[model samples]
Target: MVERKTIFSYLPHLILLIGIAVVAFPVYVAFVASTWDPATISNGQMPLRPGPHFLENYYQTIFVGTSRTTREPVGGMMFNSLVMALTIAIGKIAISIISAFAIVYFRFPFRMTAFWVIFVTLMLPVEVRIYPTYKIVSDLGLLDSYAGLTIPLIASATATLLFRQFFMTVPDELVEASKIDGAGPMQFFRDTLLPLSITSIAALFVIQFIYGWNQYLWPLLITTRDSMQTIVIGIKKMIVTQDALTEWQIAMATAVLAMLPPVLVVILMQRLFVKGLVETEK
Candidate 1:
């Protein structure tokens, strides 16, 4: 019976391991390809060992030659991406927390209907509004600028919804006690609610940060010039050469680079994320 119980406990873990590998195999292939020369990739040869050319591919993508002229470097494009992503992440978190707190804790008119309407926006993806959004950005003279890319996405339904749901799990009794002790709404939130909701906030942060970081269509549509482009956009361009034969190696290398920042953020926040969720249940 003990042995049978042990098998049952391990079954789910074994399945998850298989699932992770299935999802990760393509990423592994891309990383391996990035370490090889384009010539080897084009010839359909699989990488047997890591080659010295990976750094060469990375350096070429990030820097211009000695007699450089007429283009921004890949590293500069990546910096733009980082700035945009960080801006959106911070702004979205602030807005979502405020909106969620208001809806959950404060009394307001048409609040339920307004919240539902905003939640519906999640159904309509950016692709559906591409042309109209482009025209609006251009009309506002925000095209090819960071403002165009970051401002429109500062409000997100998913974040607000997640935060609201989490906030509801917070006890009204604790909030009432704070109020009795002379805590105003803002004071109540700052002193009690926000501290308790840290885990849910961390989880939401990871999800929203990844969403902003991986955003492609809206940024690409708004920014036409290479100088204003993000890392993902530049990587997309790098994949296709002058004659349109894809440079698979360099493209893979850029992809690997772009994926690293978010992965690191998630890994760092994972402990807080688990703890937060556990606290929410209490």
Candidate 2:
């Protein structure tokens, strides 16, 4: 027999649709603004629908650098952001997983102490430690570089704790079986743990990638050159304090472009990301 629906059953779907509309409306407006000319947007004459200048505004935003606030093209900024995001995501995963594996598998002195230390770092985020971290990075000549943008932010104590928790849930029988099959620590990790951790990795990668992409304060402090700016920073720079001088259409286009990468990442990894979050048993 088919299950019957009720008014209550439809409430959640209705709520979700409302939430989607609330979130998407601004983005839709931004896209429309991006397609219009600066005068239309500035004079508040922009229509809800897209304009014919989509190609011109986007081409100028992407390739031909903006006129007033930032002289660097959005393309270069996007590249900088992509590099920083990928490096941070991959670096955090590699470091956290290895740290978690050692803390879980190997029996060493202060093992729990080490794990607690890592966990404690969750309380001391980058903002809390920005001063000393910036000093070190500056002294090391990493300012205005990709390393400066990512290294200080890549440790990810939260990811380490997550991996540690996941590793603990793994059955000891699997470890014994791996040993019996002539697999060493590295071999077992490489062949077994890595495969098992794929979903978790994807989940963390998405989180960290967005974290890196949206970074503004740290990148702002470190990067002095226009060429080294990320897309988020580029958006900020494009909208000058002087309203007339600011290229509204170009800024809106840049804003729309800035959102594309992270959105694409989440879309592509939606499956693994959801699995990693909700999956409990191995």
Candidate 3:
């Protein structure tokens, strides 16, 4: 028998649509503003509809550098952000997966202690340890470098915990099967575990990538050169405190461009991401 539809059944969908509208309206305004001229935006005459300067504004934002605060083109900053994000995402996955594998499979001295230590670091985020971390990077002359941008932030306790929890759920029969098939630890990890963990890896990569891309404070502290800035910092720089001089159109364009990569990653990985979070059996 078919279920009957009711007004109450539609409530959740209506609420979700309202939430989407609330979130999407500002983004729509930003996109509209990006298509407008600086004068139109600064004078508060920008229409709700898309403007005519879309191509010009985006071309200037991507290629020709903004005038006031950041002279570096948005493209360069996007490149920097891309490098940082990819490095952080890959590095976190590799290190966290290896650590989790070892913790779950290997018998070593102080294994639980090591795991606890890593877990404890979740409390001490980058903000809390910024001063010393900055000093060390500065002393090592890694300032304004890709290494400086990514290395310090790559050791992820959250990812490690996630991988560890997933690994713990693996059946003992699989380990025995691997042993019977003459699979060494590395072989097992490479051939068996890696394939099994793909969805989780995809999910974590999306998260870490966004985390790295949107980094502001740490990049701000470490990087002085315009070439080393991320998209997030570039957007901040474009919007000057002086409203008249700020390139509102270019800034809006940069903001819109900055959102694209993360959105694409989420869209592409949507299936694996959802599975990684919810799936249990191998």
Each model's lDDT comes to 0.78, 0.88, 0.88
lDDT of 2: 0.88
Q: How high is the lDDT of residue 172 in model 1?
A: 84
Provide the RMSD of all predictions against the true structure, rounded to 1 decimal.
4.3, 2.9, 2.8
Over the stretch 1-282, how does candidate 2's per-residue lDDT look in tens digits? 276786688888999999999999999999999999888888987889999999999999999878877879999999999999899989999999999999989999999899888878878877887788889999999999998899888887778888988888889998999999999999999999999988788877777888788898899889989999998988998777778898988889999999999888778888765664454222
The runs of at least 3 residues in candidate 2 whose Cα sits more than 4 Å from the true structure, single-residue gaps closed, are: 1-16, 275-282
Candidate 2: deviation at residue 79, Å?
Answer: 0.5
lDDT of model number 3:
0.88
**lDDT by residue for model 3 (171-232), tens:** 88999999999999999999889999987898777777878888988999999998899999
Q: Which pairs clash in model 2? A: none
Error in Å for residue 100 of model 3: 0.9
Question: Ten residues in a row with the worst lDDT in model 3?
Answer: 273-282
Ranking by TM-score: 3, 2, 1
